[model samples]
Target: MKTLRHITLVVRDYDEALAFYVGKLGFDLVEDSAQPEQDKRWVTIRPPGAGPQATTILLARAATPEQSARVGDQTGGRVAFFLSTDDFDRDHAHFTAAGVTWVRPPVDQPYGRVAVFADLYGNLWDLIGPVPGGACVG
Candidate 1:
Protein backbone atom coordinates (compact mmCIF):
# COMPACT_ATOMS: atom_id res chain seq x y z
CA MET A 1 0.00 0.00 0.00
CA LYS A 2 1.06 3.54 -0.67
CA THR A 3 1.24 6.18 2.02
CA LEU A 4 1.24 9.94 1.87
CA ARG A 5 4.62 11.18 3.03
CA HIS A 6 4.98 14.95 2.86
CA ILE A 7 2.74 17.95 2.41
CA THR A 8 4.44 21.11 1.18
CA LEU A 9 3.41 24.24 3.01
CA VAL A 10 4.24 27.55 1.42
CA VAL A 11 5.63 30.16 3.76
CA ARG A 12 7.13 33.62 3.55
CA ASP A 13 10.22 32.68 5.48
CA TYR A 14 11.43 29.35 6.73
CA ASP A 15 12.76 30.58 10.06
CA GLU A 16 9.57 32.43 10.94
CA ALA A 17 7.48 29.41 10.12
CA LEU A 18 9.80 27.27 12.19
CA ALA A 19 9.52 29.68 15.06
CA PHE A 20 5.76 29.42 15.09
CA TYR A 21 5.53 25.70 14.43
CA VAL A 22 8.41 24.54 16.58
CA GLY A 23 8.68 27.21 19.22
CA LYS A 24 4.99 27.83 19.72
CA LEU A 25 3.19 24.74 18.46
CA GLY A 26 5.84 22.33 19.78
CA PHE A 27 6.27 20.36 16.59
CA ASP A 28 9.42 18.33 16.09
CA LEU A 29 11.99 19.44 13.56
CA VAL A 30 12.63 16.32 11.62
CA GLU A 31 15.28 17.78 9.31
CA ASP A 32 16.93 21.04 8.30
CA SER A 33 19.53 20.53 5.63
CA ALA A 34 20.88 22.80 2.98
CA GLN A 35 20.03 22.09 -0.62
CA PRO A 36 22.87 24.08 -2.10
CA GLU A 37 21.97 23.32 -5.68
CA GLN A 38 18.68 25.16 -5.36
CA ASP A 39 19.82 27.63 -2.71
CA LYS A 40 17.10 26.32 -0.45
CA ARG A 41 16.88 24.36 2.73
CA TRP A 42 15.13 20.99 2.87
CA VAL A 43 13.22 21.43 6.04
CA THR A 44 10.63 19.08 7.43
CA ILE A 45 8.62 19.07 10.62
CA ARG A 46 6.06 16.82 12.23
CA PRO A 47 3.80 16.91 15.24
CA PRO A 48 5.19 15.61 18.48
CA GLY A 49 4.74 11.87 19.15
CA ALA A 50 4.06 11.12 15.49
CA GLY A 51 5.23 7.80 14.16
CA PRO A 52 8.25 7.47 11.91
CA GLN A 53 6.08 6.98 8.84
CA ALA A 54 3.61 9.66 9.71
CA THR A 55 3.09 12.49 7.24
CA THR A 56 5.40 15.46 7.76
CA ILE A 57 5.09 19.05 6.61
CA LEU A 58 7.72 20.44 4.29
CA LEU A 59 8.33 24.09 4.97
CA ALA A 60 8.83 25.55 1.50
CA ARG A 61 9.94 29.12 1.13
CA ALA A 62 8.07 30.98 -1.56
CA ALA A 63 10.34 31.57 -4.53
CA THR A 64 7.91 33.21 -6.91
CA PRO A 65 5.40 36.04 -6.86
CA GLU A 66 2.42 33.75 -7.42
CA GLN A 67 3.47 31.37 -4.69
CA SER A 68 4.05 34.27 -2.30
CA ALA A 69 0.52 35.47 -2.88
CA ARG A 70 -0.78 32.11 -1.78
CA VAL A 71 1.34 31.87 1.33
CA GLY A 72 -1.45 32.36 3.84
CA ASP A 73 -4.59 31.60 1.86
CA GLN A 74 -3.55 28.21 0.70
CA THR A 75 -7.09 26.96 0.86
CA GLY A 76 -8.76 30.12 -0.43
CA GLY A 77 -9.98 31.52 2.89
CA ARG A 78 -10.99 28.13 4.21
CA VAL A 79 -9.40 25.91 6.80
CA ALA A 80 -6.17 24.48 5.46
CA PHE A 81 -5.19 21.94 8.03
CA PHE A 82 -6.61 19.71 10.74
CA LEU A 83 -4.49 18.89 13.76
CA SER A 84 -5.52 15.94 15.88
CA THR A 85 -4.63 15.72 19.53
CA ASP A 86 -5.33 13.03 22.05
CA ASP A 87 -5.74 15.45 24.92
CA PHE A 88 -8.01 18.28 23.88
CA ASP A 89 -7.89 20.35 27.06
CA ARG A 90 -4.13 20.00 27.43
CA ASP A 91 -3.31 20.94 23.88
CA HIS A 92 -5.91 23.69 23.76
CA ALA A 93 -4.44 25.22 26.91
CA HIS A 94 -0.93 24.89 25.58
CA PHE A 95 -1.87 26.53 22.28
CA THR A 96 -3.70 29.34 24.01
CA ALA A 97 -0.80 30.01 26.36
CA ALA A 98 1.56 30.02 23.39
CA GLY A 99 -0.30 33.00 21.91
CA VAL A 100 -1.96 31.16 19.07
CA THR A 101 -4.81 33.08 17.52
CA TRP A 102 -8.12 31.41 18.10
CA VAL A 103 -10.69 31.77 15.38
CA ARG A 104 -13.39 29.93 17.30
CA PRO A 105 -13.60 28.63 20.80
CA PRO A 106 -13.72 24.93 21.54
CA VAL A 107 -17.12 23.36 21.08
CA ASP A 108 -18.37 19.86 21.56
CA GLN A 109 -19.29 18.08 18.37
CA PRO A 110 -20.99 14.77 17.99
CA TYR A 111 -17.66 13.09 17.31
CA GLY A 112 -15.35 15.17 19.44
CA ARG A 113 -14.32 18.62 20.63
CA VAL A 114 -12.99 20.96 17.96
CA ALA A 115 -11.65 24.48 17.71
CA VAL A 116 -10.44 26.64 14.89
CA PHE A 117 -7.23 28.58 15.00
CA ALA A 118 -4.97 30.38 12.62
CA ASP A 119 -1.35 29.66 12.03
CA LEU A 120 1.47 32.21 11.89
CA TYR A 121 0.73 32.86 8.21
CA GLY A 122 -3.00 33.08 8.71
CA ASN A 123 -3.75 29.60 7.46
CA LEU A 124 -6.74 28.22 9.27
CA TRP A 125 -6.50 24.98 11.16
CA ASP A 126 -8.87 22.89 13.20
CA LEU A 127 -7.62 21.53 16.48
CA ILE A 128 -9.53 18.35 17.09
CA GLY A 129 -9.74 16.02 20.05
CA PRO A 130 -11.33 12.60 20.22
CA VAL A 131 -14.61 12.01 21.95
CA PRO A 132 -14.80 9.69 24.91
CA GLY A 133 -14.51 6.06 23.82
CA GLY A 134 -14.38 7.18 20.18
CA ALA A 135 -11.89 8.26 17.57
CA CYS A 136 -11.28 11.82 16.40
CA VAL A 137 -14.16 13.67 14.73
CA GLY A 138 -14.27 13.50 10.99
Candidate 2:
Protein backbone atom coordinates (compact mmCIF):
# COMPACT_ATOMS: atom_id res chain seq x y z
CA MET A 1 0.00 0.00 0.00
CA LYS A 2 1.21 3.45 -0.87
CA THR A 3 1.66 5.80 2.06
CA LEU A 4 2.26 9.52 2.26
CA ARG A 5 5.66 10.64 3.51
CA HIS A 6 6.71 14.20 4.23
CA ILE A 7 4.71 17.40 3.94
CA THR A 8 6.79 20.43 3.01
CA LEU A 9 6.40 23.47 5.24
CA VAL A 10 8.04 26.72 4.23
CA VAL A 11 9.82 28.50 7.06
CA ARG A 12 11.93 31.59 7.37
CA ASP A 13 14.73 29.67 9.01
CA TYR A 14 15.47 26.09 9.83
CA ASP A 15 16.73 26.61 13.37
CA GLU A 16 13.75 28.72 14.34
CA ALA A 17 11.39 26.15 12.93
CA LEU A 18 13.18 23.46 14.86
CA ALA A 19 12.99 25.55 18.00
CA PHE A 20 9.25 25.75 17.65
CA TYR A 21 8.44 22.27 16.44
CA VAL A 22 11.02 20.38 18.45
CA GLY A 23 11.64 22.64 21.37
CA LYS A 24 8.08 23.75 21.96
CA LEU A 25 5.74 21.29 20.32
CA GLY A 26 7.99 18.40 21.34
CA PHE A 27 8.26 16.83 17.91
CA ASP A 28 11.11 14.45 17.19
CA LEU A 29 13.74 15.69 14.79
CA VAL A 30 14.12 12.96 12.26
CA GLU A 31 16.93 14.48 10.22
CA ASP A 32 19.00 17.62 9.82
CA SER A 33 21.75 17.40 7.26
CA ALA A 34 23.35 20.16 5.29
CA GLN A 35 23.18 20.08 1.51
CA PRO A 36 26.02 22.42 0.82
CA GLU A 37 25.71 22.15 -2.95
CA GLN A 38 22.18 23.51 -2.87
CA ASP A 39 22.82 25.80 0.10
CA LYS A 40 19.94 24.13 1.84
CA ARG A 41 19.43 21.59 4.56
CA TRP A 42 17.20 18.54 4.71
CA VAL A 43 15.25 18.89 7.90
CA THR A 44 12.37 16.69 8.94
CA ILE A 45 10.38 16.29 12.12
CA ARG A 46 7.51 14.19 13.35
CA PRO A 47 5.23 14.05 16.34
CA PRO A 48 6.50 12.31 19.42
CA GLY A 49 5.95 8.54 19.48
CA ALA A 50 5.18 8.41 15.75
CA GLY A 51 6.20 5.21 14.08
CA PRO A 52 9.03 5.09 11.56
CA GLN A 53 6.66 4.90 8.62
CA ALA A 54 4.37 7.67 9.78
CA THR A 55 4.29 10.91 7.84
CA THR A 56 6.78 13.61 8.84
CA ILE A 57 7.17 17.31 8.14
CA LEU A 58 9.90 18.65 5.92
CA LEU A 59 10.92 22.11 7.03
CA ALA A 60 12.00 23.81 3.85
CA ARG A 61 13.61 27.21 4.20
CA ALA A 62 11.91 29.80 2.06
CA ALA A 63 14.21 30.52 -0.87
CA THR A 64 12.29 33.28 -2.56
CA PRO A 65 10.21 36.34 -1.77
CA GLU A 66 7.05 34.68 -3.02
CA GLN A 67 7.68 31.59 -0.95
CA SER A 68 8.43 33.73 2.09
CA ALA A 69 5.19 35.58 1.58
CA ARG A 70 3.31 32.33 1.89
CA VAL A 71 5.18 31.13 4.94
CA GLY A 72 2.13 31.20 7.17
CA ASP A 73 -0.87 31.65 4.93
CA GLN A 74 -0.30 28.62 2.80
CA THR A 75 -3.92 27.78 3.25
CA GLY A 76 -5.28 31.30 2.84
CA GLY A 77 -6.66 31.98 6.31
CA ARG A 78 -7.83 28.41 6.72
CA VAL A 79 -6.63 25.71 9.07
CA ALA A 80 -3.50 24.27 7.49
CA PHE A 81 -2.66 21.34 9.71
CA PHE A 82 -4.23 18.81 11.98
CA LEU A 83 -2.39 17.58 15.06
CA SER A 84 -4.09 14.54 16.45
CA THR A 85 -3.48 13.41 20.00
CA ASP A 86 -4.60 10.55 22.14
CA ASP A 87 -5.15 12.73 25.18
CA PHE A 88 -6.73 16.09 24.52
CA ASP A 89 -6.44 17.69 27.95
CA ARG A 90 -2.85 16.63 28.39
CA ASP A 91 -1.67 18.10 25.12
CA HIS A 92 -3.87 21.15 25.37
CA ALA A 93 -2.49 21.99 28.80
CA HIS A 94 1.07 21.26 27.72
CA PHE A 95 0.78 23.44 24.63
CA THR A 96 -0.86 26.24 26.57
CA ALA A 97 1.83 26.16 29.24
CA ALA A 98 4.43 26.12 26.50
CA GLY A 99 3.11 29.47 25.24
CA VAL A 100 1.24 28.20 22.22
CA THR A 101 -1.35 30.70 21.03
CA TRP A 102 -4.87 29.40 20.90
CA VAL A 103 -7.22 30.97 18.39
CA ARG A 104 -10.20 28.91 19.48
CA PRO A 105 -11.04 27.23 22.72
CA PRO A 106 -11.50 23.51 22.90
CA VAL A 107 -14.89 22.39 21.71
CA ASP A 108 -16.53 19.04 21.52
CA GLN A 109 -17.08 18.36 17.85
CA PRO A 110 -19.12 15.47 16.60
CA TYR A 111 -15.93 13.62 15.69
CA GLY A 112 -13.75 14.64 18.62
CA ARG A 113 -12.55 17.37 20.91
CA VAL A 114 -10.84 20.07 18.86
CA ALA A 115 -9.12 23.38 19.39
CA VAL A 116 -7.54 25.74 16.94
CA PHE A 117 -4.06 27.07 17.57
CA ALA A 118 -1.50 29.01 15.61
CA ASP A 119 1.95 27.73 14.94
CA LEU A 120 5.15 29.75 15.13
CA TYR A 121 4.58 31.18 11.65
CA GLY A 122 0.88 31.76 12.28
CA ASN A 123 -0.28 28.68 10.40
CA LEU A 124 -3.48 27.41 11.91
CA TRP A 125 -3.67 23.89 13.22
CA ASP A 126 -6.46 21.87 14.69
CA LEU A 127 -5.50 20.02 17.82
CA ILE A 128 -7.92 17.11 17.81
CA GLY A 129 -8.40 14.13 20.04
CA PRO A 130 -10.91 11.39 20.60
CA VAL A 131 -13.74 12.31 22.92
CA PRO A 132 -15.72 10.12 25.27
CA GLY A 133 -18.81 8.70 23.52
CA GLY A 134 -17.64 10.23 20.25
CA ALA A 135 -17.15 8.43 16.97
CA CYS A 136 -13.45 9.15 16.44
CA VAL A 137 -12.09 6.63 18.92
CA GLY A 138 -10.43 4.66 16.17
Candidate 3:
Protein backbone atom coordinates (compact mmCIF):
# COMPACT_ATOMS: atom_id res chain seq x y z
CA MET A 1 0.00 0.00 0.00
CA LYS A 2 1.08 3.53 -0.77
CA THR A 3 1.69 5.75 2.25
CA LEU A 4 1.00 9.46 2.32
CA ARG A 5 4.14 11.54 2.90
CA HIS A 6 3.38 15.22 2.47
CA ILE A 7 1.00 17.74 0.98
CA THR A 8 2.55 20.47 -1.18
CA LEU A 9 1.01 23.91 -1.71
CA VAL A 10 2.36 26.15 -4.47
CA VAL A 11 2.50 29.76 -3.43
CA ARG A 12 3.56 32.84 -5.38
CA ASP A 13 5.87 34.17 -2.67
CA TYR A 14 7.82 32.18 -0.13
CA ASP A 15 8.31 34.99 2.41
CA GLU A 16 4.61 35.77 2.59
CA ALA A 17 3.66 32.15 2.91
CA LEU A 18 6.32 31.55 5.52
CA ALA A 19 5.11 34.52 7.56
CA PHE A 20 1.54 33.26 7.62
CA TYR A 21 2.40 29.66 8.37
CA VAL A 22 5.27 30.19 10.74
CA GLY A 23 4.52 33.59 12.27
CA LYS A 24 0.77 33.55 12.52
CA LEU A 25 -0.33 29.90 12.44
CA GLY A 26 2.44 28.77 14.82
CA PHE A 27 3.89 26.10 12.54
CA ASP A 28 7.59 25.52 13.09
CA LEU A 29 10.10 25.83 10.25
CA VAL A 30 11.25 22.27 9.80
CA GLU A 31 13.28 22.40 6.60
CA ASP A 32 14.29 25.54 4.76
CA SER A 33 16.64 26.00 1.79
CA ALA A 34 17.05 22.37 0.94
CA GLN A 35 17.83 22.82 -2.79
CA PRO A 36 19.27 26.08 -4.01
CA GLU A 37 19.80 24.99 -7.60
CA GLN A 38 16.13 24.16 -8.06
CA ASP A 39 15.16 27.27 -6.10
CA LYS A 40 13.28 24.86 -3.89
CA ARG A 41 12.86 25.29 -0.16
CA TRP A 42 11.28 22.26 1.38
CA VAL A 43 9.39 23.72 4.31
CA THR A 44 7.49 21.38 6.57
CA ILE A 45 5.27 22.58 9.41
CA ARG A 46 3.07 21.00 12.03
CA PRO A 47 1.15 21.84 15.19
CA PRO A 48 2.91 22.18 18.52
CA GLY A 49 3.66 18.93 20.41
CA ALA A 50 2.81 17.01 17.22
CA GLY A 51 5.12 14.05 16.76
CA PRO A 52 8.12 14.32 14.42
CA GLN A 53 6.69 11.64 12.18
CA ALA A 54 3.43 13.57 11.77
CA THR A 55 2.41 14.38 8.24
CA THR A 56 3.96 17.60 6.99
CA ILE A 57 2.50 20.33 4.82
CA LEU A 58 4.99 21.78 2.35
CA LEU A 59 4.85 25.44 1.30
CA ALA A 60 6.27 25.16 -2.18
CA ARG A 61 7.20 27.98 -4.49
CA ALA A 62 5.13 28.32 -7.68
CA ALA A 63 7.62 28.26 -10.57
CA THR A 64 5.17 28.06 -13.46
CA PRO A 65 2.02 29.83 -14.57
CA GLU A 66 0.04 26.59 -14.63
CA GLN A 67 1.10 25.72 -11.10
CA SER A 68 0.23 29.18 -9.84
CA ALA A 69 -3.19 29.05 -11.49
CA ARG A 70 -3.95 25.66 -9.97
CA VAL A 71 -3.05 26.72 -6.43
CA GLY A 72 -4.97 30.00 -6.86
CA ASP A 73 -8.11 28.21 -7.97
CA GLN A 74 -7.90 25.71 -5.14
CA THR A 75 -7.83 28.56 -2.64
CA GLY A 76 -11.57 29.15 -2.77
CA GLY A 77 -12.56 25.50 -2.66
CA ARG A 78 -12.84 22.78 -0.02
CA VAL A 79 -9.12 22.02 -0.04
CA ALA A 80 -7.80 22.83 3.38
CA PHE A 81 -5.37 21.77 6.07
CA PHE A 82 -7.28 20.33 9.00
CA LEU A 83 -5.76 21.53 12.26
CA SER A 84 -6.34 20.06 15.70
CA THR A 85 -6.96 22.16 18.74
CA ASP A 86 -8.07 21.65 22.30
CA ASP A 87 -9.95 24.95 22.50
CA PHE A 88 -11.74 26.10 19.40
CA ASP A 89 -12.84 29.38 20.93
CA ARG A 90 -9.32 30.37 21.93
CA ASP A 91 -7.94 29.46 18.55
CA HIS A 92 -10.69 31.44 16.82
CA ALA A 93 -9.97 34.43 19.00
CA HIS A 94 -6.24 34.15 18.28
CA PHE A 95 -6.79 34.12 14.55
CA THR A 96 -9.15 37.08 14.78
CA ALA A 97 -6.66 39.07 16.81
CA ALA A 98 -3.92 38.22 14.32
CA GLY A 99 -5.96 39.91 11.55
CA VAL A 100 -6.47 36.65 9.68
CA THR A 101 -9.43 36.70 7.28
CA TRP A 102 -12.01 34.15 8.35
CA VAL A 103 -14.35 32.61 5.79
CA ARG A 104 -16.68 31.43 8.53
CA PRO A 105 -16.96 31.75 12.27
CA PRO A 106 -16.52 28.68 14.44
CA VAL A 107 -19.41 26.25 14.19
CA ASP A 108 -19.96 22.89 15.87
CA GLN A 109 -20.17 20.00 13.49
CA PRO A 110 -20.88 16.32 14.21
CA TYR A 111 -17.17 15.62 14.56
CA GLY A 112 -15.91 18.93 15.85
CA ARG A 113 -16.09 22.70 15.90
CA VAL A 114 -14.40 24.15 12.84
CA ALA A 115 -13.41 27.60 11.70
CA VAL A 116 -12.29 28.27 8.18
CA PHE A 117 -9.62 30.86 7.48
CA ALA A 118 -7.39 31.97 4.65
CA ASP A 119 -3.63 32.08 4.65
CA LEU A 120 -1.65 34.95 3.16
CA TYR A 121 -1.46 33.05 -0.14
CA GLY A 122 -5.22 32.51 -0.01
CA ASN A 123 -5.04 28.84 0.94
CA LEU A 124 -7.96 27.82 3.13
CA TRP A 125 -7.53 26.02 6.45
CA ASP A 126 -10.03 24.29 8.69
CA LEU A 127 -9.11 24.69 12.34
CA ILE A 128 -10.96 21.88 14.08
CA GLY A 129 -11.54 20.75 17.63
CA PRO A 130 -13.22 17.42 18.29
CA VAL A 131 -16.64 17.61 19.89
CA PRO A 132 -17.46 16.27 23.34
CA GLY A 133 -18.74 12.66 23.38
CA GLY A 134 -17.57 12.35 19.77
CA ALA A 135 -15.23 9.40 19.61
CA CYS A 136 -12.43 9.52 17.06
CA VAL A 137 -11.41 6.17 15.65
CA GLY A 138 -8.21 5.83 13.69
Q: Report, for every candidate in turn, its global Cα lDDT versus the true structure.
A: 0.94, 0.93, 0.75
Give the runs in model 2 whose Cα sits over 4 Å from its true position: 135-138
The TM-scores of all predictions, comma-separated, are: 0.95, 0.96, 0.85
Off by over 4 Å in 3: 1-3, 132-138
lDDT of 2 by residue, 32-121 (tens): 999999999999999999989989999999999999999999999999999899989899999999999999999998889999999999
* Model 1 lDDT tens row, 96-131: 999999999998888789999999999999999986
Error of 2 at 122 (Å): 0.5
Q: For model 1, what is the error of residue 90's alpha carbon versus the real structure, in angstroms, after optimal superposition?
A: 0.3
* Model 1 spans with C-alpha error above 4 angstroms: 132-134
Q: 2 or 3, which is superior by TM-score?
A: 2
Pairs in clash, predicted candidate 2: none
Candidate 3 lDDT over 8-127, as tens digits, reads: 878787788778877887777777767878867777777766778777778778888888886645645774677788777777788888888998877778778877887786767788
Ranking by lDDT: 1, 2, 3
